[model samples]
Every structure is written in C-alpha cells, then in structure tokens.
Target: MYLIEYLKSADSLTIQLSLTLLFVVVYIIVTKLTDRIIRRFGRKNEIALPRVVYTIKYFRFVLLVFILLLLGITWDISFEGLSVYFLSFFTVAGVGLFASWSILSNVTSAIILFFYFPYRIGDRIRIVDGDNSIEGIVFDLNMFSIVIKNEHGQKVTYPNNVALQKAIIMLK
Candidate 1:
C-alpha cells in the first residue's frame, strides 16, 4: 500500500524504469561485442575460454553496479545518504575481517593460486613445513583449500594460505 502510493505520486519512477531498461539493453549489446572480441582473439591464440568468460563476467558486474547507481540517482536517492551507508558497510566488513583473519588469509591465498596455478589436478605435490611433510596427488582446488589424495587413498585438505606459504615440491 505504501509502495503503491509512493509510485503513484512519483513521475521519476517511470523515468528510472526506462533508464534501467535502456541500461540493460546497452549492457547486453556491449557484452555481445565483448564476447565476439574475446572469441576472435582467443581463437588466434590458444587462450583459455573459461578465464576469458570469467573476466567478461567481472566486467559485466561492475557495469551493472554503475547502471544501478545511475538508476538510484535518477530516482532521487541521495548520494550523501549512500556515502554514510557505504561507510557503515565497510566498517562492518572490516570488523568481520579482523575477526576472521585466518579465513581471510586462506581466501587471499586461494585467489593467488587461481592466477598462479602452481599445481593442477593429478599432479603429485609435497608440502614441507619444518619437519612435517605431506605428499599427495592434487584432487581439487577450492575457494579456501586444496584437496589431495595420498598413497593410502586418504583425502587431505590444506588451507590455501598455509599450503602456498610453505615449500611445495611438485613431482610432476
């Protein structure tokens, strides 16, 4: 009832909706163009398609955020108010990060692993730290850790941050 009353009085809502639809159409067009460019370049060089697709998706997400911000402004949402909201959000995020330092470290390491790709599935790896060593075949690479299968057929999981920090010997 309140939403209907607000919409009925606001001519800006129609303008916001039109702008949002236009943004979506333009976004689709731009994405299609990007896909063609990626395909053309990727075909010439043997670039991985999944990585290219992920990059495109990230770009699209940023573009969508910008479009949404524009829509909000068109609807007369106050930028000053948004700044306070974002500041509060960042403060909360910072507190959460401080509370979960180990988890954050693991996530950072996983992101690095994704780009560096020191080890892949089926590769034999030995992780050494001081006197301890774990040897196994790489099974999977997840967001927080790496999974492996040892000679005894036991599954082992190592947090990415710790695993990447130590000496890793790739046998294959």
Candidate 2:
C-alpha cells in the first residue's frame, strides 16, 4: 500500500533525532518556568513549598521518560518492545512503592501537618481516640513519630500517621 511505501521511504533516524532535540529543549524551558512560578508564589506564602517542588520534579522526570519513548518509537521501534522494557521497570517500582506505602503516607501527612500548624512542640495536646487517651506536652516532632511527655512523666511516642488521624485538643 501507499502507507507502507511512505513508511519505508521516510527518514526515521532524522525524525527521531529531531524529536529528541525538541524534547530536550522543551524540558529545559518547562523546568525554568516551573522554578520561576514556584519561587514567585512560594515566597509570598508563609509556608515552604516542598510538596509543590517534589511534584514538579516528578513531572519533569516523567516527561523526560516519555520523550525518550517517543524517540524510540520514531525510529521504528515496536510498541511491544517498549511495553516489555517499561513493564519490568514499572513492576520493580510498584513493588518498592507498595513496600514503602505506610512510610510515604506518614511522611506526606507530616508535611501537611508542618504547613497547617495543628500542633507544635511544647504545646499541651490531648489525643482521644475511643478508649485510648493521652494528654501530654509535645516534646519533639520527627519524621516517624511525635514524642510527648504525659503528666505522669511517661514519654509516649505516637507514629506520625496515627497522630494525624486522631483529633488533637490543644490545652493552654
């Protein structure tokens, strides 16, 4: 057919190289734009924009991978081949993500808590969830846990994720 003839006659290598170069240029421009935007907005706000920065970085990485795949396709690489390549990579990434889901979730919650100012160190806080109750002064806030010292002088450590989920009452 005419389509087959056109495909065979097309300069696939040239197309691939051009696309690769274009992708690189676009990526650089996007990164600069994102940095400028984040700086402009984030500076005006009281809280630091770690999540936004992380999201932009992740997006850039994904875009770079997409561009590379496009380059391969333009050079007459088959979709089946690409799928096989990405499948293994995705499988490994998925397993790692699954294994670390709890940690990641807790870290994300901690980031939100940091910006929200729900409770701070040295603040008296009462956490009541069903029959479990702990009234204490927050001593430390770390990545994994929040350390609190109760009236009985007992140091209690609650996982960050668990602390975020419960209702916290601040007392003067």
Candidate 3:
C-alpha cells in the first residue's frame, strides 16, 4: 500500500526516469548492432580497421545527438530554446563550413567508398567524365581524395565526391 502510494505520488518523475532509462538502453543496443554490422562488412570487404573505426566514431556522434534529443523530450525540455541556440550556432558556423562544403562532402563520400567501392588500391580503373576522363591505377585512397597514377606515370588526385559522381569503368 505504501509503495503504491509512493509510486502514485511520484508518477511524473517515475515516468520520466523510466523513459530516460529506456532511451539509454535502446541507444546502447543500437550502437552495438551498428558496430557489429560495420565490422562484419569491413571484414568481408577487407577494409582497413582504422577506416572502420573512424566510421564507427562518426556513427556514435550521430547517435549521441539523437540520444540528447530523446532525453530532452523525456524531460520536457523546450524545443524552442534548442532551436534558437542551434540556429545561432549554425548561422555563425555555416559561413565557414559552407565555404568548404566540398571538403565535408568528400569526407562523407570517403566513408561510403570505404565500405562499398569495388575498386581498391592498385586497381586500374577509368573515370568516364567527358573531356576530363581519367584512366589510372589507384595509388592511394585518402579521406579527401583518391590518388591515381596514370599510364604516363602522372599522379592525379581526385576528390572523393567527384569520384562518386562520375561513372567508373573497372579496367582490371
């Protein structure tokens, strides 16, 4: 009887705590699942462990932001306040980030290429961009760009974003 009375009296707080715990549990489970999938895919593709780890770190950041939003809602925090803060922050940061948005795109593309790109280092491939087509052996893959050495021994650095946008022909 006393426990029931206490629970009734603390209903709001109890519900809030329960929801927070649930969110944390769910977030943990999701993180583990994603990490497992990433590792499995990386192993299957022979991707470098460092690249897989970096991808997992990026995923964790996204998950953290989602968990924060979930907790905020559970606690009845004001969305308007968060929106205003983020608006101001992004507005100020956007200027600089926007100027170099291509860099960001390259990084994103690099992550995608890490897992799904069929061509690997030493693979001979051709990028079919009319008037700018490139045929080369992939020399290196970096976060920002792919370095390829052509038949003439000319080294070309192609941005990851552009690589993804262009059609690739696997010569070998």
Candidate 4:
C-alpha cells in the first residue's frame, strides 16, 4: 500500500523530526493569531492600552513554554523531568523577584483593569478612599499607575495596586 511505502521511506527519527517541525509551524501560526486578536481588542477599545501590550507579551511567553513542553514530549522527555526543571527555574526567579512583588502586583492589577475597568480616558470618576478620596478625569494609564487630571488641573499618578482596592464611581 502507498501508506506502508511512505512509512518505510523514512526512519522513525526522521518522521518524528518532521512532525516536530510541523508542530512548531502550527505553534507559530497560533501565536500570530493571538497577536492579531489582541490587536483587534485594543483597537476595538479605541486605546492601545498598556495592558494589551503586556497581555500579548505574556501570552507569547506562555505559548512558548507550552510548545517547549510539547517539544520535550516529542523527544521522549519525562513529565517529571519537565516539572523539576520548571520548579527549579521558578524558585530561583521567585527569590530575585521577591523585593519587587509590589510592582508585580500592580502589573497584575493593570491586566485585570484592562478588561474590567469601568472608566476610560476622558471619563470623570471618583475613587472612594475615606476623606482623602480623589476625583478626576482619567488622563492616561500605564503598567504601574494611572494618571488623572484633577479639579485643580493637577495630574495625579495613582498606583495601580491601590486603584483596585478602592471603590470607583463613574461620573457623567
């Protein structure tokens, strides 16, 4: 049969190599599609928000990790080996990133706010924080903080971490 002939034409290693290459190609196509989806999302929101950029980068990183795991599987690597490798890597990274955990928290909040934040640029809003609450029109938002133009025309940069903790009232 033609199928039997084709299978006999290549060694097992060669067939596996071909399949691995195909997997990489598919991974690349999926990564590009995610990028396009992120772009379209940003455009639809009418702002190429900083969180969108971060999301795309994070999405690619996660996908790369997945494909690398698949590659390891293709090469007959054990799951336990992969788990040990990732665990050790993240452990070292965690030690180094400990001091800057607050920064990391803010970045995480920014990602959440990107999808669910009720206010947009030019929207007047108030943050409830006891007597010291601030009211302003959102001017800009970046990974770390959000800039707001206050009643006195002062541009206030509020940390994203705190933004999530407070109650936000959108004003007309």
* After superposition, candidate 2 runs with Cα above 4 Å error: 1-10, 49-56, 103-172
Alpha-carbon runs more than 4 Å astray in model 4: 1-12, 49-51, 77-89
Candidates sorted on TM-score, descending: 3, 4, 1, 2
List model 3 lDDT by residue over 40-148, tens digit each: 9989887767678878988888999999988998899988878999899999889878988988899899988987799877899999989999999998887888899
The 0-to-1 C-alpha lDDT of every candidate, in the order given, reads 0.76, 0.73, 0.89, 0.85
lDDT of 3 at 123: 92
Give lDDT tens digits, candidate 2, residues 74-152: 6677878679878999899889979877777776666556546456677899988778888999887765667899999
Candidate 1 lDDT tens digits, 1-172: 9867866787876757867788779878987887687667545554445544544565577778887887777778888978998999989998998898778788667656655665677789999977767899988776678888999999998888998778899885
Q: Going through the candidates in order, what is the number of backbone clashes in each?
A: 0, 0, 0, 0
Candidate 4 shows a clash count of: 0
Across 1-172, the per-residue lDDT of candidate 4 in tens digits comes to 9857877898879877977998899888999999899888777887655668887887888899888878887888887867898899989889878967878888888878776777788999998989978899999887888899999999998889999999989988
All-Cα superposition RMSD per candidate: 8.5, 6.6, 3.5, 3.5
Q: Estimate each model's TM-score.
A: 0.58, 0.52, 0.81, 0.75
Highest TM-score against the true fold, candidate: 3
Locate the minimum summed-lDDT window of 10 residues in model 1.
Answer: 42-51
The TM-score between candidate 3 and the true structure equals 0.81
For model 4 the TM-score comes to 0.75
